[model samples]
Target: MDPFDSSDDSDDDIFFRMMYHYYTTDLLQPDPTSLLTRCAMLNRNREEGHKHLYRDYFADNCVYGAKDFKRRFRLSRDVFLRIANALESRYKFFQLRYDARDRREFTTLQKCAAAIRLMAMGESPDTMDDYMRMSERTARESLYTLSRGVVEAFGDVYLRKPSSHALQELYVVHEERHGFPGMIGSIYCTH
Candidate 1:
């Protein structure tokens, strides 16, 4: 593993070594995949996939304490870590401004996702917890963490970094047959 051993190394080896230098944590994420598409590469069968994922994939400490989670939801190691990092950066200001320590549980990712779904469904924190099987406090906290100013307060210069992604237009239609808030449109359409 010489620093000057460029003769026998591939690009990936160098990339991983550079990544390791900064990230001391041994958490290399699994591939994050979309929910809708069931492609061979993306969709691993639950039975076989779960077994394989649980075996030697996690970096020694990546368990979420949600009983019956296999039946309740689907998430890979990569997504979980990504969400954790996102939440940490998202509310770094609020955390530091008040000298609050991070409650960086595996549930943080799930909590954020649940928060968005609850907001979209017009459900309050406590109500969302009942369906989500999450305690009320955790749900409330994640929602409170997603603040733009909080990130800047932590000295990130910007809340959200500018993207080079080319903008695209979306066409959405609504009809009266649908119920309340039936005429909402999102440019990104993630929700």
Candidate 2:
């Protein structure tokens, strides 16, 4: 009947032993936040590389120009700028800053372009470094932050369910084109 006695093989004794082990062993481990934060510091030394890749190449009309920029980035420069502006205004992490060493960090333009390219092309983050002049880790972080920022900033307007009027218009267009009144869309089922 004693609670501290380990001789008993009851379920309660087993539960207590497991709980005690978890608390004393796993819960007492040192915090890993510092290590993770240190590793997360962005490599601002790549500023020159980023400028060369983005400004000198992508934005230069004599090189990639507006058409090539649109094709490669999957967005027009104006649209890209608008999205980057929204992200920068809404998310502090997307804003460029100076590191402790007074080195300039990646610009909002670079982060947005990298993230948009990854999403649009579905390429591995490793492949982005050569063209984007960003580390793979930085590219991944940019994608993560940009995606979440976009969802938070523009999800209400872009990702919401269609309104009834919109749905009705879509139904009318589909019916006229396909000759089916009730058919909303086509589905391909595979076994």
Candidate 3:
């Protein structure tokens, strides 16, 4: 018999027919309860309610005060403000805005603080929710946007190759400190 002929009643043909019938009649049908549940879940407010953690910990005169801000954020308050200002000015995403309902959104300082903390401490975004009062998704987005803004705004000055004068200065400092006249610096590798 021809392989494509439907008249064949072989075991292989029977198995193929059974599998096709099962998939089309059972596996392909959508469950109504699952669909409704998914819609309800999406419409529900899954986000945690507003918390004052950011204000209580960072804004108030807590451990993040002027004296300890540097230790916590790995940068002085003034320096942090400067960086935040630069980022906000350069990137509209970092700028604060009001929602359509006229609700004020997160400030640039908050976003920068969250992003900087994540970068400095190498912590997961979830860790910042308690302190920053931000969702993990928001925290991650802030980290990405802030990092890109910082690189765009400051990368040229900080990441550039050393100029001749700068290199000469480095060479002189190295020579004076190590007594190696021509050696600029040393690199160490560890396994």
User: Judged by lDDT, which candidate is best?
Assistant: 2
Q: Sorted by TM-score, highest first, which candidate order results? A: 2, 3, 1
Q: Candidate 3: global Cα-lDDT?
A: 0.72
Task: Write the residue-wise lDDT of candidate 3 on 11-85 in tens digits.
Answer: 899778777777766787888777766332221111222234344345555535776677777888777888989
Candidate 2 structure quality by residue, lDDT tens digits, 1-191: 33456674888877887778778666678687765655556543567766666764455444667777788778887888888999999888788888787877788888888889899889888877776678788899999999898888889998999988988998899779977776544453121
Collision pairs in model 1: none
Compared to the true structure, candidate 1 yields what TM-score?
0.30
Where is model 3 poorest over a 10-residue stretch in terms of lDDT?
41-50
Better of 1 and 3 by TM-score: 3
Q: In candidate 3, residue 152 scores what lDDT?
A: 85
- Give each model a TM-score: 0.30, 0.63, 0.60
Candidate 2 residue-wise lDDT at 149: 84
Clash counts per candidate, in order, are 0, 0, 0
lDDT for 10 in candidate 3 is 88
lDDT of 1 by residue, 1-191 (tens): 54435677898887777677547645554356655566453221323322333442342553543333322335444544554566656564223231123322323444555555455455677764334445566567666664332343443644454343312111222333443332334443454
